[model samples]
Target: MNSLLIALVRALRSHCWLRLLGCAFILSSLGNGLTQVMVFGQLLRWNASPGTLTFAYMLATLPGFIGSVWGERLCRKMSPLRILILTEVFGMVALVFPLYGLLSHHIPALLVIQSAEALFSGMSYPALTLLFKRGLSAEELPAATAMETLIFSAQVLLGTGAGVLLFNVVSPLCILLLDALSFAASAILLLTTRKKFRVRDAQTMAADFPAHLPLHWKHYSPLQKRSILLLPALAAVGSPAMALLPALVQQIRPEETTGLALPLLFARSLGQLFGPLLLSADKLRQFSTSNRRILLCLVLFLGGYFLLSPLSAWPAVSLALIFSAHLASNVVFALGTFGVLQNFTSRQVATASALAWRGQVMVAGLATGAAGLLAESIGATGALYSISLASLTGVVILLWRYRT
Candidate 1:
């Protein structure tokens, strides 16, 4: 842990842009985490069926995949700073509907707002990736990513705990207002620091495009391509299980929904918090030679879903499993993936990042939608087991294809 902190400090000191981006990400993550809990709670309060909630999640995330394609194109035409600022502004605007929905008590408006926010949020990834690829040295990327994971985990802890507390004490509307303000603050910080960073078009840096490969796919190597394609499968493995959490909680303790769920959220956040420590720069370099470790972490992550399904009758055990699974998954999937992408040349990183993110959200949406249907038909436990098995199959395939 101390080594992780020292590495983060060194990475931040190495780049002024990283410090600026880190500040913005902190605020953005806090808002995102809080809004996620608040929105899920509100959906439950509205008596939304599992299918409805998961469908909404699917719709909200689908646009992100499309937006990611556009983001790559935009990266070539505009500066990363401009794209970031514009998307941030759009994100703030997208929140207005939710803010109004809170006052009007309209569920549909909130759903629409979620989808709109996702659209704007998705577009920001390419620009952010470009910034990281352009600004940070190869030596700094792993530490920088670990720092990001740590900050995000901290925000998840703060946001989930505080949002629930505030909702019970005050009103959900207050939480929405706070989330909007966080976006505004993040935008202001980015705008102010815009001039301090350099923005470059990733395409301009490439010496030549390969004639044999399709133009759009020319930037990625075979391993990078495999990595991007596998992201959705990895994402699908865990998303269904997570999407069914509210249903799982309601099944175990109907009256203590928020109370019981908060612990699970905290456990997940704790996993995320400590998960990145294993991905410190030195550790990442040590592990970069093989994908075997990542595949193993994913297998454990999926195994947790199967474990969780049986332990719903025992909340304590379920929570413990959740923590362990989430911690392992975050380390292998989240930080490990970023570390792999960072190994790519600067010219390839932005496109690889965008494509990987696009695949993740797209598959996650589909997986969530499927989870809802399965939960409605076969119950939450069945859905969890089904996704876990499916994810485990994906892991086996990955292991066979990408052997150490």
Candidate 2:
């Protein structure tokens, strides 16, 4: 018992700061999620008009579009830690930037605020990715991913609970204030880590920046180039699900929208947990290599979607099935994502991650925006079915080319 306790203590102390920042990053991210849900879910309360909420959501996505173009420049010169601290500080500013809308009743100001938040978030993901790479080894990446999913799981669980509890208890600005404080805490932690690492690099802003006259697209190997090209497509699929799901639920059962939709959200997180465990338990690899496992996971995931769509009456059951399928899709998606990512990059992880995230955000923003609008018109469930079917079909096409 004493030995077991000591071992547990040792494990807990393993790479303390990296783990800490990773955890804090999630907490702040959760706060962001809370703010977004509270605001978007109750858009009518914010003195909003029809389709304005949807527009706001899209505005929040614009940063990624711009982020991909410039993110790599910053990552190349700055430590991931520094990049995180800077982007998040800016993110806090972004979160608060919209208060003027409520204060003066200016719609355009609020739109700008949402855009800033998305922009800062776009800048932060690459830094986070770099930290994840630095924080874990090849063997530990799966566990690192588990921890990540767990943090996101808590975001949904905790943030939703808080958003609900505070709906009448506090103002949205109050929630935003708390997000700011979390950012401050995260920045402090990052500063401490920076001092500890004392990483001194010569990379300068000007050197890494896209040149004024012309941008130099770095030469990439065939596989690497293919991976970069594929990034936008893969991200497009992953980005749209959350924004669209609730709208879909509303279409089916407006009365039970939150209850039906939130649980489905939980199910995706739950599925993510289960999907990773399957890999952690060695089940995913029971078939073959990482590549093989990824393909199998995708194939099964698509099948899960087929099973999901046909269940007409049991919306609850259907939600669970569909989310679970998505969960498998996410796992393989992450596996394929990171597996390809780690292998694909010739540059430092930070720069590569920045480029990749930029691609993701660019594609994800468009996909999510489109999905949200489509959900309002087509019935959320049907839209999901079409997306699932179409996405799977596209994958089959890509895989055929992959074989050749």
> Largest lDDT belongs to which candidate?
1
Give the lDDT of residue 192 in candidate 2: 80
lDDT tens string, model 2, 182-247?
Answer: 777877877786675443222333333344433223654544434443455455554454455555
Worst 10 residues of 1 by lDDT: 206-215
lDDT of each: 0.70, 0.57
> By TM-score, how accurate is candidate 1?
0.89
Worst 10 residues of 2 by lDDT: 281-290
Cα lDDT of model 2 overall? 0.57
Pairs clashing in candidate 1? none
TM-score of each: 0.89, 0.76
lDDT of 1 by residue, 42-101 (tens): 877777777777776676677888788878777766777778778767777777777777
